[model samples]
Target chain A: MASTEQEVLEGLAEIVNEETGIDTAEVELDKSFTDDLDIDSLSMMTIVVNAEERFGVRIPDDEVKNLKTVRDAVTFIQSAQS
Target chain B: MTSSSDTRIVVTGLGATTPIGGTVPETWEALLAGRSGARTLEFDWVAEYSLPVHFAAQIATPPEQVLAKVETRRLDPSSQYALVAAREAWADAGSPDIAPERIAVVVGSGIGGVHTLLNQWDTLREKGPRRVYPLAVPMLMPNGPAAAISLELSARAGAHTPVSACASGAEAMGYAVQLIRSGRADIVVAGGTEAAMHPMPIAGFAAMQALSTRNDDPAAASRPYDTDRDGFVLGEGAAIIVLESEAHAQARGARIYAELAGVGMSADAHHITAPEPEGSGAARAMLEAIETAGAALSDIAHINAHATSTPVGDVAEANAVRRAFGELAGSIPVSATKSMTGHLLGAAGSLEAIFTILSLHHRVAPATINVDNLDPEVGLDVVRGEHRALPEGPIVALNNSFGFGGHNVALAFRSV
Candidate 1:
């Protein structure tokens, strides 16, 4: 089942929260993982892997660099799903 | 180079998460009570793999109970145990007012992060390479414990890991004394941590016949110096001590446990796994420790022996002690605490060092339990049946720790 954009954002936020201990409310779409959320590369990988399992979407390594912010990740997931 | 005696060093604080106890105080109390920490293995893999040995001296309190979830997830169990012990020791030292550059961390391990390495290997083989954790290398490195503690305390002086198998902890402590005496660091968090209680190590040890096979009676299995002793009971945990220069400690009015007067280390070129039967190398380390401490034979009152309870190793260490002190070795009250705590591998030295220091501080030596019938060949005065009270006044205690690869370390602690 393809997840809606709102559903993707919520799901991604939960993954980020679990991996980084950042508050769910703080994982806004505009927040940059490195600057705003303070998530390092290793933690980002963990979150990405977890998100892939949770949403049933494959986030390729090449595309990981393109995920600059929460909005970017949600947009990428939505496009991949469609 | 300045002599070790010129710059006095003392143990300001101690910590441990061992089979007998989660903290130093608890372990000390259990040691005094003559309690056995070994028990039957509870993991299903023991049965699945049909491991000959079914028990080990597992950690009394799991790290997850003491550490936060995020910390536990990122660090390996070896580092987790080191962090737990280091934190306790630091807090016990009243969180010394030393600069980051003036403090260092040296935690050694006989087998570091074996659980992580093996588990990751299994994951890689079963789930494919992509599924392996990114932090696997850092988590599995032998220096992970020292690095973890250095990171935790922001220690900038130096982080060192001396891997000498079982003697690693004591050697690390010996190195800590060098660090302070040589004017490199004012305070050093030195000790050892090991968490190799996985099925693989158990099977490996069993293959070598290094472990006791008394699956039915685990506690009595590690009977050091006992005529019926078979082999050592595998164990795991970490023990840490806050070592600081006397000048720095006195300046800050920090309480001192015991003065770590000197450390001696030697190597037996005889064999890789087996100790030199005559114990010449071990005796040299013991004699060097006493000489370095500037202690006369009469001043040495107690010994925390490295009696792992293995049939050959026990006798070898007994011969080593007799060779070192000659006639006086028979009179010194010796305690093989491993009979209760089992062999903690790398952490054995530091844990036993803490026991030796506590023996001096409390003026009571903990008893060596399970020696129902002491081996007549072991001529040393093994303290058994009940704890022995030390004579009042100045005295020194020796903590001996030997390891595979022919490593031998002896440390002397003088009561303040």
Candidate 2:
């Protein structure tokens, strides 16, 4: 099983931003990429690709389509890890 | 009674997440420069499956470089590619200030979220049903790409998916044109996306002998119209274009690419996997498109062919081209771009349509790469090696797409 929510967040924080010298903590779970983090579509796709690599599980196209929030992604990762 | 002038629909913006490039400009540049996106699989499952055809045109820029860590976990790769392309097109269209009800989205795919389906099945077997994510249904659905775009644009007119195998993308663009012409929507985001570079699809295609087995030369493997052409190479990517009514485009001062003159669709009803031997249905579709556009056969200067490099498919499409062009067949230049891009399956048609429009806009038709020995059976003028320059002044080009289910679609575009 995966770690607790906070631990998962801490682990994800190490992912690192190639553009800006920052951590995943800069991206709030609820804030939309277009609005909050300034993440574009290409950036969003990179995030998904990284998540699949990190979690070692494949996220389906349908589920990825609805992933507008950070919580949706974390919950999905948790389920995949289980 | 005098007929009113037909409303001209033009391509206002283009976006693509293709095997060669991430955006439309990048893909277009690579396509013209003759870059090959095909490469061997880096995934470990390739060795496990013992797949014969190992290479594929995976997206040059992976989505992981762009998406957030958590956000990436929830969606399938197909949807991610679609969204990536859609955002570029939407922004390229200057983010039109239109009501949600007046916008529509039509993005199709041959195989939607197969990666998600296979992976989830692995999870179910390795772990348990409770471990499966709840969003599997949405991810695996064929309409996932179109639905995601609809939500992004807040399109309410309708969101549609045309799953006509390889012709899916072209058909979606056709549907978008109709939506605007029929007064359903003022603008539409239309194209196709596919991320089926998985072990199952690759193994399945290899089993069917549908993919090229020239693993030694990945780039030269997808050789359309060549004497040694075996089969198409599998590819993954998305291409989306913004189609708007002429009136709306003029009002907004949009930079129009080319007027989407007309579209013709037909069904072979001959075979599920094979095209009609004489290419009757494909010919009919092309002829219908010419008639719909009210253009003479001689008006078409070029054709962006959906030559998937399959031995039978190439000949069938070649026959169709010769039949449709008739006396002008020898003059019109036909470009088989799959020579470079491989078979994008569902997204082939839409991306090819973009190629056609660009050819018209720039007056330069990109050459069909890797055709060292053209099949003598192909009668039409097949452009090869270097790009060919088109004759000056209002030129029309045809984009053809044919799917596995014998679905034939032809779209005609004229320079603005």
Candidate 3:
């Protein structure tokens, strides 16, 4: 459903913010989910599940591990779409 | 608090979130007032499941309303109950300044996170895998309550959860006593919790014919030792007590409740659901507690019975007491606490242990709520109507907890 990588990242920021109480406005491509954002692993599962639903992507457990940063998730979603 | 002997273990603190009240003081007050906490169910699933038993003794103050919104969201109800009671016990013990590596946690539950598991499964079935919460596995695990408390208190020495059906909570306290005696830890936050007021458990229990169908008069339903007593009133809550060596408590000057003198355990090895009719296992558990405490039958001034109000269980337990205490059983005041608090399942043992400890402190025994016509078959002297003052001088009390799968545990507490 996201038409661009920027759109994918923006959509994910909202989901992450809702799940982990992190502010979506501060979310960026350079920020890591665990280190920079301080999001826990349980919240990461929610982020991955939501992304799969919102972007119509199949982010399996193995693929979820590689999605370390906001940019990684955005790129993964965009590439999978293309 | 100074220990003069090697096996001297003392209870430094106590806490509970029970059917009667939220905190220890409130629960004790209500217990003395002879109040019943059972009520009709507010959930729609009670009717949906067509459960024969439509009422339960739900906690007076639910942990959700007390905990933060995010906390309630992340932790299952069972874990929430554990956190609430554990924090209270820790604070009650003056928040001991023990090393993190020297402290431990042991909280048990009969059926853990049943509500969360059933709810998540329903979500996955109806809305797909994406709708399933990521923390579902941890939230639904049987040991989640103990794990949550361990993390909350940073108990690195060891975090243990002992599951033994309804005997789980009592077993945790028994384990804590061993941990201190074995030099594993100085202080252990231990107890039992149960949050299984959901439809699946209710239906399952109903199918097994374990619940009373006293839909009309819920308060008088848990009539233990009464001629017409049917079965137990399903209940939910948690109770925790802090255990420490007498030397450790004396070192910190922590106010002591009572000596968690000894725990006696046994297995019927006969029946899984039904207790051994002769009460052999139950009696052995009582005898073991007395022997372990180095106390004679005459030393036990009172008993907090595991009388679940089941027609068979009450008599079996009575027979067990008779066997263990001999002629002394008829003289010992037996308080069937479940008559008022209903049955807390896993939480019953620790809560009753708290009650036993409190009974020793208050110098009074709380009465059983509804025993309109005491069964003639029941041989023990049932505490009824009003709470009675216990005799002066040092006294000992026993709290009996027998669970399904033939598990029997008896904890003996002595006046400080």
Clashing pairs in 1: none
Docking class of 2: incorrect
Fnat of all models, as shown: 0.38, 0.00, 0.50
Local accuracy of candidate 1 as per-residue lDDT tens digits, B1-416: 12254798999999999999999999888888888999998999999998889999999999999998778888899999999999999999999877899999999999999989999999999988877888999999999999999999999999999999999999999999988888889999999999988999989888999999999999899999999999999889999999998888888999999999978899999999999999999999998999999998789999999999999999999999999888898999999999988899999999999999999999998888889999999998999998899988999999999999999999999999
For residues B1-416, could you state the per-residue lDDT of candidate 3 as single tens digits? Answer: 22233568899988899999999899999988889999999888787867788899999998867887567878899999989999889999999998898899999999999989999999999998778998999999989999998999999889999899899999998999888888888999999999999888888887888888899999999999999898899989999999999889988999998998878999999988999998999999999999889899999999999999999999999999999988898999999999989999989999999999999998888999889999998999999988878898889999999999999999999999
Best by TM-score: 1
Query: Which candidate has the highest DockQ of all?
Result: 1
Local accuracy of candidate 2 as per-residue lDDT tens digits, B92-144: 99999999999999999998889889999998998777456557778889999
lDDT of 1 by residue, A1-82 (tens): 7889889999998888776677899999999999999999998998888888888889999999999999999998888887
Candidate 3 chain B least-lDDT 10 residues: B1-10
Model 1 TM-score? 0.98
